[model samples]
Target: MINDTIVAPATALVKQAVAIIRLSGPDAYQLINKVFSKQVEKKQNQITFGYIKDDSKVIDQVLIMSFVAPHSFTGEDVIEINCHGGVLVTTQIISLLIKKGARFANPGEFSQRAFLNNKINLIQAEAINDLVNATNETSLKFAMNNLQNSNLHLIKKYRDQLLDIIANIEVNIDYPEYDGVGDVSAEELTEKLVSLKAEITRIIKLSKIGKIINDGINVLILGEPNVGKSSLLNALMQEEKAIVSNEAGTTRDIVEGKINLGPLTLNIIDTAGIRETVNEIEKIGISKAKNEISRADLVLIVIDSSRELSLDTKELLTLTADKQRIIVFNKIDLIDPTKLVLENFKNERIALISTINNNIETLVNQIMESYHFEELTKDDSLVLANLNQISLLEKVENFIKNAYNNIVNNYPVDIVNVDLHSAWYLLGDLIGENYDDNLLNTMFSKYCLGK
Candidate 1:
């Protein structure tokens, strides 16, 4: 148990209606009682109005919310004092708490303490941070589902199944003569393990989609100069964030913007047109554009519809051919939209667009459809957007598959149990049934102060 008390402002230290100073630990009540004029032995979960006085010097009027140990958020005595929102008033209250033996809390210490005390598992703890930082509705829902330990329940289901399998192996090994104990044959074991593998495979696929939904997609707008790349970016963003000029090479640097298409976000970046330029500054911008192309998750290759593809345009298309991209035939208003046909690149993702016509919704819908996480929402499946969680699950899948392969090879059940046991341990790690201190520290360190 933590013996020392810690305190920090739970709200931003700005001009607002109120500011909250939170404390948690064994001495939380003791520290608060020293400064509060109201009685400290109020019923648990009760809030009382009070005044903070420093040896008869009234510091501020406040509201004291109290929670006793083992039931509070951090599994300790926690107190939250809602004081007036003023720089001087908040600072004075914090300083008074410190003088009363309360140390300032570190970043995520509250949630870290909750995990250490078994009040919440690592997955749920992470959900709290993710919830606070979610960028869109989809990302918010993903984090919200995780807060209910949706992924934890899923891991527990797999854990229980593996434990049953391990128990069967133990029975077969120790009670060879006892027919009542029952044992699973190699063929039956293989079937069960294969079913488990298939479930993990589905989870892995969904996690990939969840990553796109949660982290959003990085899109690079690439083409020869004067192909309306900047105009398309503006149309997608619905704002004049990028300069739109008729002259070539007007966009000398990367212009970035974010657009939300309901379920997904596009971090669109417009780069300098890829063409040979004598100007040194334009050359540097072109180099940066090349670097961005390599890092982009999706490339938007714009082509002029009125003119045939130039040799340089064909080369640029070939460069991003292997990448996940959408070939955009821009300036469609200049051509017959009804007769438009991308015959050569029939297998590629193609979109006919006219930024001047404000017909960019087609491209937006295509991007959304490509990264839809509807599977996760339809069955109300739990989300595992965290990369660490997905990686651990993939490891579990590998171990389970290994055990299945062993059974298929007619190996002894004991040999199969070795791999099964390895899987069980990893599944436990996934739910944080067992954890490394350093791993927990690293995960929670990314949180904002007083989280």
Candidate 2:
């Protein structure tokens, strides 16, 4: 409820230079004044320096930022206590506030309140979360645009367009006598629906890239034993994350590490070498490796050029025949450097490198070439968000497609109106025009406690 005050640490409670404790609700100002040495008036956006005390005993010297009603975030009276970042001090301040009548805030309660009060929509609220956890510059740019309602604008635009069409159809159905009034022919209607669906399809394609950026790409390092698979993981991560062993079958489990290659982040998994082994644990590992290969976004088929392509190497190539893969000829340094001058490196899917020399730049660049993003600089709105946002968009796309099909099948214009309305509502769900408590609970629960 907005009437009761909710207080929470607005920053990580670790030992740092400063920690902020946020309070929001109707009685927020009143609750803060109860414990502070100095009184805080209804002065909006003013920072006051004061001492937090238990009667006469000083607790901590702090700075309080006061935000008065209706215009602040959450559209309620708000207060933020900026104190020393000692965990003990922050915890004490919160405890004092609780004793002074402010209850602890739930995870994402601040953003949730902002949504309920119409300060920001669902997509923008989600964008706020993404902004906090953004890994690289590219993702940060997308998150900032999302904060500015980039995705919300698109969803609202689509929703409004559908609503306008629905209203037009209703009017036309009710009044057939009116000449050139709400007059949308069946052909024109189908065309509009088809066009809308096509636009959504394009966005969905871009959204997959957004997902890869926000959630890192899953890359599987696969090969037979002694093929430098572990070496490849270590080289990419630039760390000794996986043990590089000369002994075959040393790595009998999945070893994972993450590395950001500019905009693209790869969750590299070094699995057990895929070869027939009699050992039960090694067999289990081999089975696990195969399972992971199915779900991998990209597979690095590492082959040791130091030795001849054995039957195991050929079988590895045959296995990843249709997968999105890069053929890595490891131990290229073992090849004559004079011969390297004669060979043309034209193939993007094939990389020749020596991890021993730490010369895997060709493989790294090849990865960046795999995803063709022709300068995502134009518009960030095309970038979709998390699974929830993507799934909702999928629903919108489906409804639009169904609407198009109904129109093409010569169904009544009103029948098309039904799907359009469903799509509009789904878009509303994306932008949070219509939603329930359960949706808010599930989405915001993923957010940080202080957020």
Best by TM-score: 1
RMSD of 2: 2.7
What is residue 181's positional error in candidate 1, in angstroms?
A: 3.6
Per-residue lDDT tens digits of candidate 1, residues 3-31? 78999888888888999999999988888
Root-mean-square deviation per candidate: 2.2, 2.7
Instruction: Rate residue 334 of model 1 by lDDT.
Output: 96
lDDT tens string, model 2, 1-451? Answer: 5678899999998999999999999888888888899899998799999999977888999999999877788888999999999999999999999998989998998999998899998878988999998886667877888888755567667877888889889999899899679888888887888888888888787777777767778899998888889999999998899888799998899999988889778989999988878999999998898889788888898887777666776776777777888988888988874454313225428888899999999899888887745634345455775888889889999999888888889898888888888898888888887898897998898888878
- The whole-model C-alpha lDDT of candidate 2 against the native structure comes to 0.84
